[model samples]
Target: MNVPVHVLKGAGGKAAEQMAAMGIETVKDLLFYFPFRYEDFSIRRLEEVQHEERVTLQGTVHSLPELRFFGKKKSRLTVRVLVDGFLVQAIFFNQPFLKRQIELGQHLIFHGKFDKHRLMIQGAIVKNAQSDGAFEPVYPLKGDVKLVSLRKWISQAYKDYGDEIEELLPESLLESYKLIPRAEACYFLHFPQDMAKFKQAKRRMVYEELLMFQLKMQYFRKQTRESTDGKEKSWPAEKVNSFVEALPFPLTAAQSRVLEEILKDLNSPYRMNRLLQGDVGSGKTVIAAIALYAAVNAGYQGALMVPTEILAEQHSASLKELFAGYPVTIGHLSGSSKVKERRETLEKLASGEIDIIIGTHALIQEGVDFHQLGLVITDEQHRFGVAQRRVLREKGIRPDVLFMTATPIPRTLAITAFGDMDVSTIDEMPKGRKPVETYWAKPDTLPRVLKFIDKQVSMGHQAYVICPLIEESDKLDVQNAIDLHRQIQEVLPHLHTGLMHGRLHSDEKEEVMKEFAENKVQILVSTTVVEVGVNVPNATAMVIYDANRFGLSQLHQLRGRVGRGSDQAYCILLADPKSDSGKERMAIMTETNDGFELSQRDLELRGPGDFFGVKQSGLPQMKVADIVEDFRTLEVARQDAAKLVASEAFWKSEIYAPLRQALEEEGVFRKERID
Candidate 1:
């Protein structure tokens, strides 16, 4: 991990200090930050050159043409440099330094793009001709970073300190996976001798990183398991069934299956750690409500923790209605409640008066206590870290945990991120929740869309117009929420309109949300901060401005804010019509309403960065792990690692001792205890 300060300096001078700002401290970090792309310097045959491509061809030197300037300022210098075998025009606008770099009759390795008329254009790579040019990895470079110099520097680094790199993974896992040597992975990652080793190296690194992450997760799950009493509340499943039957809508098969899985955990002595994956309008709350009912029936209180006070209040209100006739008093605890009210709620919770409590992080605060908490449910599961959830669990009597999320994660990411939990997905939306109608439009079409919203508002319906920008910014010319709020006010002057963005105070935000929920506001203009933990049943429309700026999962979440009620939801994705990417995004939105597929698309488009960003538990630190590129390796590693770690045999193995110590390390990813 120690990068010589000299490598960045080129000659080991003050230049080294500049690259440090980018968080590039070590050679290892620099090496691992592989090229986002590569410019192939290997010779391309010119006669068969294709248009709009990077090509290299070897032939006798064609005549070097004139370096011309076409601009009025005469500053635009265009250099047409001929390759060894072919004639091509290299057009550079005001690029004088490029002319100095090019030479005649040198047999130069010319690397650039060619258009239909053999015009070499745009940003392309060129190099000195070499007799033997291996697969050159053009790393993401700085002042003097290219395929050639970077390789030389990295070769120097390995030549000096390659032996010093400690093999981090266990020997058995490494051998069993047929992984490349750790040093080899590092070496080829920077300058791969061939593509086969390059691919293999990527696999090894991905597997190594995922394995470490999986092991850390297993450690935490195991550590938490030790403290639990292996106690399960023996409540009649029939009561839950009665509650389900009593509901107005029938439970989907997915709901029924997930509930059975939950009941099995409740019946068993083993403490449960389960994830409930429900889509946008899926009925995760009902299953949680049934679990709460069971806990109360067994004479023990339960708590449901959501990420936001707004959602907590929403859950509390719903549960109160659901458990109306049942012998249970529900308590709502949140920062929004008055001090005296919070105290009253906490005291009732400490006593036997409250059967179920729902709130945000306020429920886990110092003064709040639960007399006998038997079950705990967390909505939007990724919002809270393992430590935060563990603190909430400590509030209960070894409460069995049920984590629920709307983000339809691919199973691999779910297992990787929440490996400790046995996942249960209520994949089907409740029978009647209509799949939202989706559309992609431009700002120019706003008159028609606003008219459409006006019609809906006139018909006594509500809509959410989401803006990308929060406020009027000097830097960005895009529409801001406050400005848009004012503009929308002009169109729908008589109707109730509300603005909700992250900049608003918590109280103001809550008030606006309350107003929206009560149908006080016919239209709510907002930012993406509304992505998490908002529930409005009456609102049937979601209009996202600059829809291309959002990821698919985030857009889905925003769309989920509406469609909670029986209303047919409409998710209108509004963006500038110019971008092809924007068009593609809108198409994804209009396509099948499957979270799994959307998540996969998201991963493909943006890589696994979205998963880490949402998880917010700290990024999985697999030095070699890339869930996208080397997913197969990661899967294999996960299977092997899970089998070993879950087994008693793992503890007895010679490698297990160090592996356990690795898990115990301060920053090594498991159950990190911060004072």
Candidate 2:
């Protein structure tokens, strides 16, 4: 059944190369090249067609096709067709060759959008024969692959190799899930008789995809839990209490609840794989600090890995302040650290002198060793891949792992993407944290906004002016951080302005952030690099230029930078959104400050692609399943996959053999075993 694309009809030379460019080299790949959308081309009478709708009509040509040239390079073909006693004009733009195919008194089926103003059909297709009342699939195409050529090739492929494809799901699952046969679903997905059948076919395919993904995730979780044994550490309640009581502020109920959950996991025998998700300024660091304190009290070392040097430095400084009176020693490691500093830090870490080490990816470098490392915590977990996390955890013997993300994700998507790890959310902000007031303004309000920023600066508070781009771009019309920094300095004249962006060197970024944090810089103009972990409690206002260019979650994170302190914070969005989506994003930012709610709205508005990079989630790319649209199907599949993983007899059955082989081919089991 693994036939090459070249063997298919008309797939030769250039055609074959085009197919290969789309990753369709085999018959299996062809089958999985699902359509992005479908169009209905069933024949309809002229009277049945609606204005501004796309439809197919069978009619006889009443007038010969005439070509008219608007200019030297542009020409259009027009003809009149008679259908059910109604005459309608058909227009084809830039297709002069269509004049020969359409003739007077010839019967043809036309498909296109109906324009009521011109009383014409802007025809995309004009076939000599009638359609068979079936939906036409619109596929994602590559270079030189015409729709007609692809359609013919696909038809020939199905005729020659459709029967060779074996069913991937078991008969019991098909019956229980009310799913059609795999071969039948494939056929119906490409050419459905009606919308109902298409829906059923899509459902079957989506269910299969989700089921496989969930099975793999569950299998990895089960394998890891059973194969790896963790250190049985005692949770000294007194020590944890003392650490919490020493905090300058009290913990919210949500934080307390999540901390209790983490404590339970640390005391358990199985190595912990947990995800700590919270909104900005939700106090996740305090929870992590308490866990590290418990690990150190249990005679072990802990390491916290972050994504950037400034974040690592920030965490180290904050932890040092939090553990000021404690006996625990903290070490910092980053790419910018001097050689002597790194060497001393490593030596201390290996000798058990450093109880807790905080650093960036530099902590995972070769020769960096840990003495009695019992816990590993990664901040902004999405920034690191599975291999990086594994490398850090391998520094110790099955150390408990905790991954934290301030980027709030929709609950359903979190379940689908991070199904292998347990989840804990700090839903409530700490006491004295004020909700930031948000507003949306146009570009004309810049002068007023600059004046407001100056006012905040004069009151001994800092402000962040965010730009969408780091530098000037000929392609984009938005302001850049570097350019905006100069403009702010020129306009404000008296305020101390600083620039921060991702392109700066690590040490340079650290210095800029340090200045901003110490109140030396009253107005900081930066890019989204400051969205993650730059904490300045004295910052009171934020002005985001072209705010519509940012996603809702990103806008929320930027807004979070200002509201960390006791003063009332304000977020001003300066954007003139032309699209509905852009306007909706700006309005949502102005409406609420809840990250979780905004995350759900963001998924609904921008889809999974913009919300979370699918490639970075470590899940297989799905052909039919959408983590946002098909969340119910995902939940069902997750439950079924868990049940299958729990039942030993199912693994040995012949019905499960094919699925096991498929999973193995995808390297799911290999990655599990290696990790």
Candidate 3:
């Protein structure tokens, strides 16, 4: 099983290199590399054949192969075959080399779509009729690797090392779940006898993959819970309550509840690994502020890490304003901080003078040190990587970690991606805030939309006209910021219009955002760069051009830019969607303002990969299990894995030896940790 793939038959030279490119380095990798799809080659009679139906036919060649050249090294190979007493033309494209293998009166099997009107088969492939299986496994190929070579090599590997593949799941689990054995699964997955057996094989593999992933999550959760170095900080009820009471507005019930949960985690002996999720303008910042104040009141310094410098500055300003009249000292740090200011801030931070420091990725740099750092809060938590968060947390001795995201993650993703952490959501809006009213319109209504924006701006409120692209693309017939900005200015030349996109320098973007926030730019036309970290309370009207080009979460986030203030806000989606999904997205946006519900809908529309970016969240890329499609199965696997991890049998019993060894090999559990 440990043998190199290069040593396998027909895989010695460039084929080995290509297989390595496909991530097949060892015999084990080859065996476990499952097929993406299977083609049914079950024999079908002419009487049962339907037009354009994919069918496999066995025949004897009635005529010699004729090869003809076409455009750019392409060729057409055709032969007349006798199938079920009828003469049919079999055609293959770009396989002129097969003419050498074809002969008169040779028996052949062809698999492709049948055209009854033409009495022909658009042959995808032609093989010797001696092939055994009723189904063909099609593997994902890369480089110059062909499907035939992969099938041949995988078959060789299975024949050589099939029984050596060890079963990772315990015997009790196998019996309870009725899962097929590991070797049998590998066989069926690579070579299926029938659809029923193939499905069974796939189920076992999917469950196994999800189970292992959950076990790793539960193990880390167990480690985090079992750690003894967590700081059991004192919750100064008097100071916290005083600060809360001093606020201008009362905390919403949801905010109060989430704050209470955080305070409880802070007071407990266990480390707080909690996720704070709320919709845009849902007052999550205030909850984080209260938590930071509590951390300071406990005589420990705190840190707030954001994704961008602008957000860092915004957080610092908001936090400082909230902590006014208190003894807490707030410091701001970023990559753009002046040399002298940074030096002083670092010195103060090290000497325990700054109670709370707000910064971007600069907070996790090597030179930055925390003075008794007891609380670590990361805003827009998904924007940061696991290692970055870990480095910030490692600055202190088991500091309680609070992660905040304005993008409301669908519950399925929250459980599968952040399964190891506790989650708290603030679904309710504050007292006087109004929900942004959304509308969808056709391109012909653009004149009316512009008139509306002009009216809003005249009424002392600003507006944002969002475009999907920065420059007009010949490929996509959508509006771009540059041209849209020019056109908007041409239409309403009197309004002070500002343009901001991702291409602008950080300082330039900041300047544009500043001008917009200060109401100097009444109408800001830009791209999706303003989809996050831009808070403009006075901007009451948002016009999204080509709104169908964006995802639901993104459209929701853009709409959130407005309606932050007490004034009623309106969002107009200018879209002429041609597809059902695009129309559905626009309809969903106008239907409700609940981010959570929209997120669930978004998950169904666009799978987990595109929902808030799956890769950026550091989620394990599974081979078989889909967190979206297989959410119920994921829930079951999570529960079962948690049960197993909680029991001593998983670590001690001989029956679980294979499971432990498998996990250990994956680095899910180290030997020393288990011991």
Candidate 4:
């Protein structure tokens, strides 16, 4: 089964090359390459055939085949077949040699779209008449790989190496799940007798794929908990309560609960790998601050890494104010840090003078070093890659990690993407916070929308005018940042407006954001760069142009920019979407303010591939199972895998040898350690 695909008959040279291009290198690979769909060619009687229906029928030739040439290398072959005492014309295009295969009084079969009114079958596939017809497997093709050759080669592989494909699951699991043998499922996937059998085979394959994936995830989680040792920090509860009481605002109930969970992990013996997720303005940073306080109190340094420089600066200022009276010393590092300041921060961090360090990716550079790191917190966790987080962790002795993300991930995605980490969600907002009111307006309503912004600004509030593109493009009719900035200044000439986008230098963006925060710029026209970092509590109005061009999660994040203050906030969406899906997205944005709901809807609309970039997320590419559609199966597999991996005897038992072998073959060990 492991032999090269070229060993199969008629699968050498060009065929082998094409198969390799499709990721089928060996006979086993060819067998496991499932078809995307099946063409229903089941034989049906003449009386049962309907007009324009695709079907197969057994018949005998009633007339000599005629070949007619139309143009260069183009010809038509026609024959009359007698089917159950009725004559029907069968036509084959571009197959002139088929005239010799069909003759008068010859028994044959035809599979094609039947035209009952004309008693003709067009584009017919002629075969020697058989008692029964089969459902043909339709595979995804590459290059000039012919479907017939693929079918023949697959059939040959099945005949020659069928016995080598053994059952992977044990009898107990098979009986409990009502699953067929591995070999039978593989065979039926390519040559199913009926739709029922095909569905059964598909269920088995999907279950196996999900089960294996979940088992490996469970195994890695077990390894992380049992193999690695973590610091058990014992901070003073009274001191923590005092620090919390000194804060300007009280912690929400959700934030309190999540903080309790994090504290428990900090005190545990194993290194903690937890994910802290919440909606916008949910006070996640406050919880991180308290956790860092505990780490610092435990006599170990802490590090907070964010995506952009603006966020790092915002967090630095806020955390400083939050810990103003405390004895903890905090330092900031970034790509644009001055030489003297960076050198001083590095010296302080190395000399144990700084208790907590905060920065962007610069915190992971070689020049930076921690005195005695204990806790690692990553803000906007998805923006950084797995390798970056690992490098920061390697600075300490298996420090406990907490990942913070504003993007609320769906449950299915959370399990698959962050399967190895314990998840804590801050679902409640701080008391007295108002939900941003969302509205959809057409381009023709710009005057009224601008008037609304002007009113908000008159009340000592600020506004953000978000555009999809940084500059004008001939291919797109949407508004650009620069042009929109100019237009806004022209329309509201008295209002002070500024421009910000990704193309601007980092320092420029930082200055623009600082001005916006300080209310110097009444209206800031910018691109999506402000989607994550900027925190302007005084900004109460957000106007988004071409809102339909963004996803639900993005629209929700953009809306979060405002509504931070006590005053009411408004988000005006300017879009006239032509497609039904785009219109639905706009409507959904206006219907709910819950980030989790929006994320689920986004998953449904865009699927897992687009909702989360699977390539960037470091998730396995599943060939059979979909995390969204097959969530129930995934749940079952997760539970079963967790139970099986927990049993001490299961790991050493020979009965599970095949399962272990499959895991090894998948290179599960080589996969990056989950955080």
lDDT of 2 by residue, 1-675 (tens): 577888886898899888999989988788778888888877877677778889888888998888999988788888888878878888888889888777778888888899766778885577658457668798889999998888888888888888876788998899998999888888888877798989889999999889988988899888757764888789678988978987888889999999999999888888888899999989899999999999999899999999988789889999999999899999999888899998999999999999999999998999899889999999998888778988998999779999999999898778777888889999998777789999999977898999998888888899999999998899998999988888888998888899998898877888888999998989999999998878898999999998978899889989988988889999999998575557989988888899999999988887876677765765456788888899999999999999998898668988888888888888887784323
What residue pairs clash in candidate 4, if any at all?
Answer: none
TM-score of 2: 0.90
Q: Name the runs in model 1 displaced over 4 angstroms.
A: 1-40, 45-77, 81-107, 112-121, 137-187, 219-230, 385-387, 611-617, 646-650, 653-675
Backbone atom clashes (below 3 Å) for every candidate = 10, 0, 0, 0
Name the top lDDT candidate: 4
Query: Which has the higher lDDT value, candidate number 1 or candidate number 4?
Result: 4
For model 1 the local lDDT of residue 53 reads: 78
Compute the lDDT for candidate 1.
Answer: 0.74
The TM-scores, one per candidate, come to 0.84, 0.90, 0.86, 0.87
Off by over 4 Å in 3: 41-133, 579-581, 670-675
Give a tens-digit lDDT track for model 3, residues 584-628: 999999999999999999999988888867657656777767788
Kindly indicate the candidate among 1 and 3 with the higher TM-score.
3
Query: Which portions of model 4 miss their true places by more than 4 Å?
Result: 40-134, 670-675
Task: Estimate, for each residue in 317-415, the C-alpha lDDT of model 1 and write its tens digit.
Answer: 888888888778988888889978877887898887988888888877898887888998888877887778889988877788888888888766776
Residue range with the least summed lDDT across 10 consecutive positions in model 2: 666-675
Candidate 1: 10-residue stretch with minimal lDDT: 57-66
Model 1 Cα shift for residue 427 (angstroms): 1.2
Rank candidates, lDDT, best first.
Answer: 4, 3, 2, 1
- What is candidate 3's local distance difference test score? 0.88
Candidate 3's displacement at residue 605, Å, is 3.1
